[model samples]
Target chain A: MKNSLLSIYNIAKKDLLIELRNKDVILSISGFGTIIIFIFSFAFDVGSSLSSSTAAGILWSSISFASITGINRSFMLESENDTLEALIMAPISRDIIYLGKVVGNFIFITISEMVILPIFAILFNFSILSLEFITCCLLANIGFSVVGTLFASLSIKVRAREVLLPMLFLPCIIPILFSSIEATSMIFQGKGWNDLSIWFQLTVAFNLIFLIFSLFISNVIYED
Target chain B: MSNIIKNKLLTCSAIFMFINLYLIFIWVPTEANQGAIQRILYIHVPVSQISMLAIILVAVSSVLFLWKRNQFWDKIAISAAEIGLLYGTIMLLSGILWAKPVWGVWWTGEAKLTTALILYLIYVSYIMFRNYFPTGSQGQRIAAIIAIIGALDTPLIYFAANLWSEAHPPIVLGPASENDSSFSSNDMRIVWLFSTITFMIFFVYLLRIRYKLQDTISKYLTNT
Candidate 1:
């Protein structure tokens, strides 16, 4: 188990380094994300008084789209180098590879979200310093990234990888979107975290279940 | 000779489906409030039920394919997914038609309908995902893994619809739900049950023909 964790850590670190050097994964996503936020701002003329209530939807939409770009690039890059096959051929377990990629993708998406959230808050004039808002976003972020990573690995080998990822991903991320919006909205409404415990529970359950199932399925797919 | 027999069976099932539709439209008693529009339930509910069953079959058979690594199980799963898509499409069409008159809108954020749509899209993407890989070259294993992970999204979509505040109520039993008691009177029950049986028989019959068709296509395509 220790060896597995160490292997995954090394793999994830290597992935991070590669991503840092290229930076296309992050820049393109954040660029596209910025455009989406501008569209939202122009489309909805709530003025400078845009309610914090609307922030949740905007935040999630931006993150979801940015994550897709990130996921697409992550696998596309790996495949470019034939790195995926090499990792599979190595002595490492398939689940460890899955874990490494999922964690790596999760971190990349988190950074994108970290950038987008504050910008969204500033442009829309919504408060973002609340602990509740941050926590809700984090849980939903993990859930989306977990499921997205699994699908990214699944999608990369497909003929229409870019088009297929969002088609396969959007529906699956609906739950995360729901919980995130609800929890964040509650916070915006001045309700405490305790009020949104059910959403949090749902988020956690979704994360755990997808983690286990994706691990198993990734293993089977890798073996092939 | 076997192919001819299978084609005949398919033709017979189509005839049965046509007769069932006639009974639903012309013979079945209409509701007091919803009137003739309620007649749509006879077809819509059953198709939706069978679609869910078809997807479950795909999921389970995919798991079997992964476990046994057998082409036969993969074929079964592919067949089931194809049939599932058929039913899913029918369900979506009938659902939209029914929703237009009842809800005063074509589509709403109803829990059941939204999730059903999401489920349909997920499986459709699965089929599309299958096209990415080369056939008979570990494609089955990759497809199976995808089908399984993709199928996992269905239940979460369903539960999310229930747990989150949504316009549509949870479907507890049958396709309409116990909440739809007003719609599920004894008169409705009889026709609905008949429609369910008709759809299931039609589904099985269609699945068998599809599997045979797939066998032929695969044989010809692979030049085996």
Candidate 2:
């Protein structure tokens, strides 16, 4: 068990280190996220003062799109370098590799969110700096990373992976997106913590379920 | 498994479906509230039920494929998914037909319809994933992983959709809403039950044919 944990940590660290060296994934994700937010703000004319729910919808949608771009790039990086095959060939189990990628993706997406959220708040004229909002974002990111990593690996070999990744990932994470959007909107609306509790629980449940299932199936998917 | 049995089953299902169409269009009393359009329920409800069933079958077969490493299970998974996609499309169209007159809009973000649409998209992506991979164990493995992950997410999707719908004022547009208690009547129940059975048989017949087609294609590919 300790060995497995160590392996997972090492793999995750390796991926993170590579990402740090290149910085392409982070730059692309943040750029794409900002562009999406800009378009949505202009399209919705947020300067006229948007409803909290509309703002929440726009914010989450941008994050969702950026996450897809991030996920695709992350796997594409591995595939381009043939590192994915090397990882599979190593003594480490596929589940450990999956866990590593999940961790790596979670970190990347969280960092991108950190950058995106401040811009979103400034542009949309909403205060999203609260603990509840951050917690919801974290929980949603975990669900996204777990499911996104699995789908990213699956789509890595496909010719049209650019199109396939979002197609495969979005529907699977609808519940996470919905709950996060709901909770975030509630926070923006100044609703009480009790109102956000159910969405929080739903997000947690979504994260746990997908995390476990992804772990279970990752080996099967990677064992080409 | 024999050709004779396949033909018999196909003929029986065809006849059963004809009987169901007659009962739906002619025998069943028209719903007073929705008039003739409500008859679409006979097709919509049964097809939706089968679509759900088909997805569940895909998930089950996917798990079994991963566990046993059997090509047969993979065949079953793909076949069910294909058939499910077909029926799900029918469900969506019939739903639109019913919704236009009843809901006064062709589409709404109502939970059930949204969930069905997402589910259909998921299946479409699943088929695309299967096709993108070259004919090999690798493709099958990836598709199985997708099927398993999708199945796990299904309940979460339902929960989130229900929560979203509840938070907003209920849309009284769909046939499954509280106001449509027509199924509470004995005749409606009987007819619905018969239609459901007929559809189930139809699902089985289609699945067998699809499975055979996949098997033959795979065989031909290998021979070539």
Candidate 3:
């Protein structure tokens, strides 16, 4: 288990390293996210209507779409190089590979959310210092990336995979999207944890379920 | 040897379908509220239940195919998916048809309807992916992986509606909430039970035939 964990770390590090050098995935994801926020801001006049209450939804949705863009490009390197084939043939277990990709995606999206959240707040005229809302944003972002990465790995091999990943993923993410939006609303409204506990529990439950499931299937999926 | 068994199974399926049609259309009385329109429930609810069951069968068969490395399980998974898609479409159509009279719209932004629509899209893409890749090409393995990932939506689609506020049809069976009174009386209970069983039998009959059809195509292709 320790060896597997270390392998996962290395694989995750490798993914990050590649992305850093190319900067293509991160740039596009954050850029796309920024454009979406600006477009929505103009269309809905979100900049003026922005309250602590609605701020969280805008931030999370922007982050979610950004991550989808990043995940699509994250695999472009592997698809071009056959490096994924070599990784599978290595001594590492497939679960490590799955975990590595998920974690790397998690980090990538987290960065995007960090950038998007503040800009969203400023644009919407909401304060960004609420601790509870920030924490919820972090957790929800992680949950989304974990599931998104798994779907990316699964769909990146298909034809018109760009369209297929979101089609396959957005439905499953509805619950996460709901809870995140709801929990954020509650926090903005100054509601107590008693009112929002179910959403948090749901987020935790969904993350664990998808993590275990994705790990088990990654071996079959990654095999040639 | 198996030809006789196949013939017998097909005959049994035809009889079961005949009995199901008689039970649902001729015997069961219309509900008090929805009247003639409520009859669509007889078709919609049964087909939706069977589609969920068929999806489970597809998931289980795919897992078996991966574990055992047997083409038989793969073939079974493929066929079950085909049947599941067919039933899923019927469920959605009947659902929309039922909604038109009762909900005053052909479709609603209800969580259940949205999730079901997404489920249909995911599996449909899975089939499209399979077709895009040539037989015996790497796409078969790729398609199976997508099938497994898409199957993850089954549970999410089932529960998302309950977690979110929607105008979708309420759950009728199991631990009834304060809404239990809506389905009061022994007569309603018996009819519900009868309809559920009738649906299960009809599902099995369809599955048996679909599986044989799959076997024939696979065998014929191999022989040619």
The CA lDDT of each predicted structure is 0.78, 0.86, 0.72
- TM-score (chain A only) of candidate 1: 0.95
What is the TM-score of candidate 3?
0.82
Clashing pairs in 2: none
Model 3 misplaced stretches (Cα beyond 4 Å) = A1-6, A47-58, B1-28, B104-118, B133-153, B156-160, B166-213, B216-224
Per-residue lDDT of candidate 3, residues B79-197 (tens digit): 77788898898898888776666656677555667667777777787777676555653555666666776677556644655566532254332222222132434554555566666
* Per-residue alpha-carbon lDDT of candidate 2 for residues A1-224, written as tens digits (9 for 90 to 100): 99998998998898789888999778878889999999998898866888888888889989999998998999988889888889999998889999988888989999998899999999989998788888888998898888888788888888788888899888888998889888988999888788999999998888888778777767676875
What are the candidates' individual DockQ scores? 0.65, 0.80, 0.37
lDDT of 3 by residue, A83-168 (tens): 88888888888878888888888788777767777777678766657777766777787787778878777665566777767666
Instruction: Indicate the residue-level lDDT of A121 in model 2.
Output: 91
From the highest TM-score down, the ranking of the candidates is 2, 1, 3
- What DockQ was computed for model 3? 0.37
Report the C-alpha lDDT of model 2 over B1-224, residue by residue, as the tens digit.
47987898889999998998889988988887767888888889999999998999999998899889898999999999999999999999999888888766787778788788888998899999888877788888888888877787777898899999888755555444547555645778788989999988888888999999999998998999
Instruction: Estimate the overall C-alpha local distance difference test score of candidate 1.
Output: 0.78
Question: RMSDs, each prediction?
Answer: 3.3, 2.0, 4.4
Best by DockQ: 2
Better model by lDDT: candidate 1 vs candidate 2: 2
**TM-score for each predicted model, relative to the true structure:** 0.92, 0.94, 0.82
TM-score of chain A of each: 0.95, 0.97, 0.93
Model 2 misplaced stretches (Cα beyond 4 Å): A1-5, B173-178
